[model samples]
Target: MFSIFKTFFWLGWISFGGPAAHIGYFRHTFVDKLGWLDDQEYAQLVALSQFLPGPGSSQVGFAIGYQRQGLLGAILAFIGFTLPSVLIMLCLALLSHKFNQSPLFEGVVHGLKLLAVVVVADATWGMYKSFCKQKLTSGLCLLTAAALLLIPSISTQIILLLFAALIGCKYLASNQSNTHQRFTPSIWPLITFGLLIFALPLMTSGLPLIKLFSDFFQAGSLVFGGGHVVLPLLQNIVGEQISQDAFLTGYAAAQAVPGPMFTFATYIGYQLIPQAPIAGALVATLGVFLPGFLLLLGVLKHWQHLAHVPKVSGALNGVNAAVVGLLLSALYQPVFTSAVLNPSDLVFVLVGFYLLKQLQLPIISIVISFILLGVASNWIV
Candidate 1:
């Protein structure tokens, strides 16, 4: 447990770029370096995390912890992975104004956006290779990608609901006999946590209610897709109440830093209510992440039985494919929309993608180069 915490702590401090980059770091550190889980198991965990809700990277972290040391480890891993971003975001919130003006800060953020593009592309490719090899699955992937591109404003929850219904229908239609058992849906934890989160606002007062409920609920809710997907839900909840500039600025800054992007909540929370920075940060961070943690705990507690269910596994497979498509969509709307504003930005993005996909250069190096380029460009132009 201690080692898990320490490992997560280090990752939280230095794991930057975005969800894709964080996955790469996890593959290198946990899979290659630590030998925590074999490749197949890791892939399964990745697939499972994508199928569930919440921040994909942080869920992956929780999955890793669960695989090694059970539920306790999962909790510890989440804490480790989450703490650095919360602390740093709080500090950044305190220095929000100056941080925004710093040329170096702008450069780092610029470079980081490019890095984010590469990371998302790479992750899409990786998932494609892993799960979309079958013709039917590959076709589904393309279809889903097209759907997302055409309807960018649709909430991911709706898409997921449609997919789940389709999977259920298909399962009911199939007559083929199989050894896999049916998974009984466990509603207790989901129900209990849901009630707790909703009741939280009533349990407290002032900023405390907002902070506690937001963080705890966000953390407990199972919101799959990735970090960018969390934005709409979060913004809908907190946008009207807080300074839009500060909220967005902190979010942009999250891209420039390491660890999970969900940590942006910490920055936004602190900035929204500075007098209670710690409490606010905690609330925001937890609110954004709580769902994933609760879902994982529920799943892990029943995975042995759930894994035997053919329909459940099949549905998860479809969801995983959709997740890949979702990531691809994100690369366009938020990421590409922001990063490639000019010819120069296009050049940097192309170079970064080439380095990552072709030359297999380290993502950190690409991020650094782009930051320097941004700084130099700002000086010259």
Candidate 2:
């Protein structure tokens, strides 16, 4: 358990390139290196995490830890992965102004953004290869991708819920002819939990309410892609009051730190109520991650029963494909738009992608190489 904690801590601090990148790192370290889980189990966990809220990478980390050492392991893993980002975000909140003005910082962030795009692209391909074997699954993948790319207004949650419902209906209709009864568990607990989470913030006041609503909403309601998707939602909510420079700076700083991207909330929260930095950070972090934990518990409790239904599994397969497509769509927006500003930047992106895909290099190495290149470019011209 201690060793797992230490390992998780190290991973939290070093993990970068967003959730997709984090997934690759997790697989490399846990599955490929440690042999903790086989490919199928790991993929299943990934699917499960995506279906739940919060940061997908953090949940994946928790699940991996749970598989290895039960509940205690899960707790330790969550702590280890979360602590570094919390600490760094708090510190950055305090130094927001100075950090934003630094050219080296901007350059590093620019390079990291490019690397993030490549990482997600690589991960999406890898997942597609693994899960898109069946014709139905492949069709779902293509359909979801097209829908996401074409439909700008529709959110991922609605898409997933609709897909899940279709699966449920299909299963019920198919089983209508069979005499064997498959017990459908009451969903009252899930309903109750959802209501409680949504209502909890309303009962609070001032900063507490802000924290509660922000965190709870993030953890429970918002679900687009992964950790990266949280940025815009948070920016819109908090940016109304906070300075744009502060928010953007903190976001860039977030990339430099390790742990879940949700920890960026800690920075925003602390800056919002710096008089009580710890309280602010804690509230923000918990608010963002709480839903994820609760949702995971609910799913784990009922996943076995759900998995037995082929239609349910089929829908999940489709949703998973859609997620990959969603990720692909994002690559062109903020990532490519912001990062590839110059010829040199383009060169760096290609080099980074090559190192990641062809060379199969570690993320840390790619990060370091890009950082050095950024620094060198700045100094040269």
Candidate 3:
């Protein structure tokens, strides 16, 4: 438990970029370094998180801890990985001035965004090698990437994944024994998940705390994409309750912070209940994140068992390949286009990539280098 908390705690401080980048960081640290799980297990976990409605990276992190140390590890993982961003968002809420547009903030954020590109590129390439070997799978990967790059949305992603699964069922299934034992998974998490969605709304009329929790829980339960997708849902949830500018500021701050972007809930919670800011932050953060973990718990073990059946395994393979394509489209649109603006930015990414992939510099060293260069360039300008 201590190891789980401590590692994710330190990771919470340095994990910038967002969900795609976090995937890369996790693959590097856990799979490559610690040997926690192999590439196949990691790929399945990523695919599962994408299918689920919540923070993609946080679910993956929680799944990792669960694989390592079960339920307690999952809880510790979520808390440790999420706590730093939650605190940062809370601090931003308490502060009178939002530094989102400040020059220093821009410099730091730019650096992190650049780092995201390098990390995501590495993850995409590495996973491609693992998941997209055969011609059909490779075609699935490239086609999925093309379609998403052309038309991107949560719906688009899900549909493509389903389409890929169909293809996998047809063409990718391996011949094996059909006999398999029945496996029953604990359904309490799924039941609790349904109950909260139904009960929270009914209980929220006169109570601000309940209202706060209900709003976030709904957003967390419904939002299907990554952290960026949650912002609009949260905006609707906070309508007229907080000023538009303040809400926008929290969005910007969430991007600037170093953990799960979902911690934007913490800021909104603090703003919603200034009288009991910390409690608000805790409740809001937990509310937004709890559903995701619960859903993970409910399906994860069953998903693991299903992976062994021949046809089901093929479908997961297709899903895994699609996952890489998702990473590819993400690496370009949000991670690349957002960060690499000019020649200098392009040059920096190339060098950063080379350092990370070819020379194999420690990720932290690369992070510090990016930060230093970004700040220096900002100062020079």
Candidate 4:
């Protein structure tokens, strides 16, 4: 457990460029170097994370830990992988007064924002090749992207996923099923998941922490896309409590941080309850992450069998394609639109994208380069 904690804690401090990059780093560290999980095993976990909601990469890390040393290992993994970013976000909340107007700090955020665009673009292409390989799957990806780009609402996303599932079941599902291990998944976790979905609302008024949990938990349960998708949901909920500037600041800081982007909640929580920020951070972080872990625990044992079932597998294929589309759309609106404001910013984005996809520079180097460029441009101007 200590080894697991130490390993992920180091990752937490330096695993930047968001969830996709973190996934890559995990693969290199655990799969390649440590030999903890084989490529297939790691891929399965990544697929599971993508299919479910809250903080996809974090859930993958948790699942890996669970496989290694059970529930306690999973808990330690979450802590190890999130603690650095959580601490950073909390500190940002505490010192917002000092840093809010710092131009250099603003430049770092700006650089990170552009880096986000590049990262998402790279992820979109990689997922496209991996998940959208088949003709029908690729078409589904395009259709989902178009629909989301045009409609641009949470309802549209949900409706498209449902429709895609139906289409997948009807067309892509095969009659022949593959053989896999026979293991029954426990029902208790499923029950707990449903219970919380229902019970959190009813209990929200009882305690402030309960309300906080309810909000973050609900966001976790609903978010299908990943880290960036959490932004809108969180913005709506936390926007009620903090200034728009503060909320945006947290989101930007989250992009630069080395761990789970969901730690953005840590910043929000601290800001919301400055008097007891640690408690606030704990509840909010746990609430947002709880649903995904519960879902994983409930389903992991049965995943092999489920993956072989034609109808279910077909639907998952559709979901995977849709995931690509969701990432594509997110790459544009909030990410590209919010950043890449001027021609100079555009130059940075193009260069960053080239460096990421073509030159294949390390993300840390790219981040550093952008930060320097941002500061230089700001100062020179």
The best candidate in terms of TM-score: 3
User: What is the TM-score (0 to 1) of candidate 3?
Assistant: 0.97
For model 2, how does the per-residue alpha-carbon lDDT over 1-381 read when each residue is reduced to its tens digit? 898899889887666566756776677678666888876577667777865666778888888887789778888999998998898788777766666557786666656666666666666676678766767556666666666557744365456546734753453222323333354544654675667566665656665546545554644357445666778778766756778877887887776665687888788778666577678778777777766765665556445466556565555555555555555555555456656777887887777778977888876788788777766776666
Please give the distance, in angstroms, between residue 325's alpha carbon in candidate 1 and its true position after superposition.
Answer: 2.2
lDDT of 1 by residue, 253-355 (tens): 7766778888877876675565776777776677777777777666665564654455555665565556556666666766677776789888887888788
Model 3 segments more than 4 A misplaced: 176-179
Which stretch of 10 consecutive residues in model 2 shows the poorest summed lDDT? 171-180
CA error at residue 147 for candidate 2, angstroms: 3.0
113 in model 2: Cα distance from truth in Å? 2.7
- Candidate 2 residue 168 C-alpha distance from true site, Å: 11
Q: Which ten residues in a row have the lowest lDDT in candidate 1?
A: 168-177
TM-score of each: 0.77, 0.77, 0.97, 0.76
Candidate 4 global lDDT:
0.79
User: lDDT of each model, Cα atoms only?
Assistant: 0.69, 0.68, 0.88, 0.79
User: Which model scores highest in lDDT?
Assistant: 3
Clashes of 1: 24
Ten-residue region with minimum lDDT total, candidate 3: 177-186
Whose TM-score is higher: candidate 2's or candidate 4's?
2
For lDDT, candidate 1 versus 3, the one ahead is 3
Give residue 165's lDDT in candidate 2 (0 to 100): 40
